[model samples]
Target: MKTFVLTALFVTIAGLSGCDRSSQGFSLPQGNAELGEQVFVKYQCLSCHTMAGYETDTENLPGSMETPVALGGQVSRIRTYPELVTSVINPSHRLAEGYEAESDQSVMPSFNDVMTVTELVNLVYFLEDHYELEPYPRTDYVSPH
Candidate 1:
């Protein structure tokens, strides 16, 4: 019962205050977050960051709120979309707070060469649309014609 209460409280707080998220990536997708879940799994993203609320049996995930290594648990410093995007593209740019600098040696693999631009955008949509975050400014990183 305590766990359930804690979880609900956390969700409520996260939703009310937001996750302090910001990004300079592509525009959010019109696709459903439910559909984006499919895109997320299809792209094999669970290998790294936790997909909040989403879970799977194959890997023994316990939802994002319970994940010990969730970004929220690690980095209170991050609060921007560009920061989030940089975390994805150039993961080596910043280490989440608390963990040692070399922690990346074991966590968050390099995706610079793996994910293509289109896939990156879709993945971002899956995150922004599906996950909750603290309020922050919005900025577009997509290039203009």
Candidate 2:
């Protein structure tokens, strides 16, 4: 009976421990938006991404017939800080829907080697700040009876 009680206790502890703790107590450094914009320019991100209310001289870069990803606007949903961080650190984690089949690989180069942690945090802050929630359009159609 002692062995059975011990086994039950071990099972209960293991089950409780297995609960998700992936993001528990995790935190990123707070960043300054102004400095982040400088980081964006210094990294020449404007070559591919279009930032709302910001302009860059991209005339020298080769023009692509394809539309570049527009970074800021009234997005359908808010992008969390962690998502932005992951995008920078692991660009190919998941391709932004339509672009997946276009190329087997991500065109975005990982800045993990070039950027400091502080710069990354700040850039994410800047990008996240630009997105605003916009209401989805109401559907007019009703299900046929």
Candidate 3:
């Protein structure tokens, strides 16, 4: 009886919290791709991420890898708008496979502090436009001792 009461209380709280969230006035502005590109450059994103077909005059700092995370282009799966926002706001939330190191922390700095909400929304829109649906290639790998 005690366990059932606790579970019911928990569910009630969760449901109420969800209702509050919807009324929080959280909405993204309609994004402009042109402005987004300017934001991307202003933020120096190209220094770390490679966007397909997009070129930048800014060079990577010394000791930085020539190739970092590749965005845009043909992806095996499409990344949604929320995913892109989360990546910018909380980079370490999810790490791509094979990119993990000893620490789970992301090398990319969080843009939560630097970017405005409008810039973030526009950036996501710009990035989403670049992805193309492509089939993943099949390959077999042999372990090398």
RMSD of each: 17.9, 9.6, 10.0
lDDT of 2 by residue, 1-145 (tens): 9999977865664456444323533346457788988888888878767778877446633343145568878887887778888888998888865555345566667799999999997898798888888878557898999
lDDT string for model 3 (1-145, tens) is 9999977865665565433322333334457777888888888888777787777434673243445678888877887667777888888899876555457877677788889988987888788788887886656898797
Pairs with steric clashes in candidate 3: none
Q: State, as a TM-score between 0 and 1, how close model 1 is to the true structure.
A: 0.47
lDDT of 3 at 7: 75
For candidate 3, give the lDDT of residue 52: 73
Give the per-residue lDDT digits (tens) of candidate 1, residues 1-145: 9999977865564455444322334232232445556656875566444545645333643232233344332232444445556667776666555443454542455666867666665555556554444365467698877
On lDDT, the candidate that comes out on top is: 2
Badly placed stretches (over 4 Å) of model 3 are: 1-27, 56-66, 135-145
Stronger candidate by lDDT (1 vs 2): 2
Please identify which of the two predictions, 2 or 3, would achieve the higher TM-score against the true structure.
Answer: 2
Candidate 2, which ten residues in sequence have the lowest lDDT sum?
17-26
